[model samples]
Target: MATEPAPISFARGAPSLDIIDTEGLRAAADRAFTTDPAGTFAYGTSVGYKPLRAWIAERHGVSENQVLVTNGSMQADAFLFETLVSAGDTVVVERPSYDRTLLSLKGRQADLRALELEEDGVNVRAFADLLAGGTDVRLAHLIPNFQNPAGYSLSGDKRRALVALAREYDVTIFEDDPYVELRFSGESQPTMLSLSTSGEVVYASSFSKTVCPGIRVGYLVGDEDLIAKIAKLATGTYISPNMVAQSIVNEFVRGGSFETSIATVKTALAERAARLADGLRAQIPDARFVDPEGGYFLWVEFPEGTDGDALFDAAAARGLAIVKGSDFLLDGAKNSIRIAYSGVTPDEIDEGVTRLAQAYASL
Candidate 1:
C-alpha cells in the first residue's frame, strides 16, 4: 500500500496540542472530584463557579457581579447577540473578521457594515464617518488584539477613539479578546471596557486558548445589570454553563498552572512564527504579511493577481491545509490568505510554506 503524505496544516487558529498540559488537567479533574464530588457534578449557577468568578473579577479589577460565565466565548457571543441586537439593527465589524463572528451576527438578522482594517487597526476616520452618517448602529464588534485573519492590534489612540465613537453613536462595542494574553512582544493596550468612559463596552475572553480547549470555560465582563440579564438567559437556556469544567479550570488557575502553560505555549508559538516567517521570506519574497507580536494567525498578502480561492484549493490538493482570505469576508479580501502557526509544529510550518510557495509559483 502506498503511504499518504502528511497534511501540513495552516488552516485553523488552534493551540498546539503537543504542549497542552493534559496530565495537569487530568490531575485537576481528580482534585475537583476528590475535594467535592457532589459540587463537581451538580448543576451550578449560571454566572459560573463563585471562586472562578471571584478570581476573574479580582484579576480584572471588577466585581463578581460584572462577570457571567458561558460554555465558551462563542456562547457569550450568542447570548449578547440575543440580548442586545434586535432584528435588522446595524452592526459594524472589521472588514476581514473572524468568520464565526460574522455568522453569529447574521444568524441574529443583523444588518452588517464593514470597516476597512489597516495595519494599526480599524480605520477610525471611517468609523467616525459611519457614526455621523445617521446609521443607527447597535453594535461595533471587533477583535482588537491580534485580530483573527488580519493579525493586527488597534493603535492605542484608535482604541480610545473607537470607544468614544461607540458612545456618540450609542453603540455597544463587543470586544472579543480570546488571544490578548498570548502576546509574545509589544506592550498591551487598554481594553475597550477600560477605555469606555460611557459604559458602552462588553468584554469577553476564554480559557480555550490558554488552557486545554476541552475546558469550555469563558466569561463576559460588563455592567452588573447587563450581566444579570444574560445570566438569566443562560439559566433558561442551559441551566448553567459546565460546572465540572469550571471547577477544573478553577483548580488549574489556583494551582498556578495557567501561567506556566501560557509561557510554554508562547515559547512554542513564537518559535513557530519565526520559522514560518523565515520560510515565507526565503521562498516567496513578494508575499506581504505583518509579523504578529503574538497570536495564532499570520495574514499574508500574495503577489498581485493571485486568486485566493484557487490558492486555497491548490494547497489542499497537495496535502496541505490553508484558509482562503475570502472565507473571512463580510465584504471581501481576495489576493491573500491566513496562515496559522499556533496549531502546527515549526517543521510543519516550514514544509507548508514551502509547498504553498511552490503552489503560488506554479500558478
Candidate 2:
C-alpha cells in the first residue's frame, strides 16, 4: 500500500501558527478576564462590547453609532447582504474574488455583475460602462486592498473613480477589506469609505489576519442608519457577538501588542511572498503571475490550453494542494489558479513550487 506524503497546502488563506502571537493573546485573555470578567462573560447588546466598539469607532474616525462589531467580518457581510440584497438584486463583484464571497452572494440569489480584476484592481472603466447602461445595481462589493484570491490592490485613481460611479449610480459600495493591514510593501491608499462624501461606502475588516484567526473579531463601518439596521438583524441572528473574544482583542490593542503582532506577520509574509514568487519563476517558467506586494494570495495563469482540473489533481498527487481558479469565477478560467502563500514556510514554498512544477510538467 502506498501512503501519501505530507501535503504542502497553498489553499488555506490563514496565517500559519508560527506567525500567530499566541503569547500576546494569552496575556490579553488574562487581562480581559481580570479587568472585566462579568462584562466579558455576560450576554451583551447586539452592538457588541462597548469599549471595543468604541475603539473601532475611534480607529476608523466614525461615531460608535456607525460601527457594528460581529462574530467575524463574514457575519457583518451576511447581515449587510440580508439587509440590502433582496433576491435577484443586482450586485457587483470582482471576477476572481474570494470563493466564499461568491458563494454567499449566490446563496442570496443575487444578480452578480463580475468585473475583470487587473493588477491595479477591478476595471473601473468597465464598471462605469455598466453603470451607464442603467442597470440598477444595489451593491458594489470591493476587496480594494490586497484583494483576496487576486492579491491586487486597487489604484488610487480607480478608487476615486469607483466612488464617483457609486455616488452617481446611487449604489452602496461594500469595501470588504480583511487584508488591508497585511501590506508588507507599497504605500497605503485612502479607504473608499474615507473618499465617499455620500456615505455610499461601507467598510468591513477583520482582526483574524493581523491577530490570530481564532480571535474571530471583525467589524463594519458605514452610515449610522445602515449600521443600526444590520445590528438589529445581528440581534435576531445571534443574541450578541462573542464578547469574550472582543474583550481580549480590546485588551490586546490597548496594551499595544496588536501592533507588534502585525509587524511580525508583515515581515514573515513579505519573505514568504518573495520566496513563492521567485520559486515559481525559477521552477515553473511557464507559470504566469503578478508578484504581490502583500496579502495571502497570488493569482497565476498558465497558458490558455492547460486544463485546470487536471493540474489540480496532478498537484494533489504530488503532495501539493492548490485552489482551482474556476472556483472563484462564474464562468471560465480553466487555466488559472490561486496560490495562498501565507500558510507555508519559505522552505515549504521552495518544495511546494518544485512539486507544482512537476505537476505542471506531468499535465
Q: Write the per-residue lDDT of candidate 2 for residues 219-311, one digit (tens) a residue.
A: 999999998888888888898999999999999988999899999999999999999999998989998988888899999999999999999
List, in order, the clash count of every candidate structure. Answer: 0, 0
| Weakest ten-residue segment in model 1 by summed lDDT | 325-334
TM-score of each: 0.97, 0.98
Give the range where candidate 2 is weakest over 10 consecutive residues by summed lDDT.
1-10
Q: Where does candidate 1 clash, by residue pair?
A: none
Candidate 2 wrong stretches, greater than 4 Å: 1-3
State how far residue 295 of model 2 sits from its true place (Å): 0.6
lDDT of 1 by residue, 1-363 (tens): 278669888987888789798877887888888887777799888998877899999888887999998899999999989999888999999988999999988888899999889999999899898889888888899898989988899889999898888887788999999999889988899898888875699999999988977788999999889999999999999997898999899888888788988998888888988999899889999899888888899999986788888888878877889988888887555899999888998878888988898888777
Candidate 1 to native Cα RMSD, angstroms: 1.4
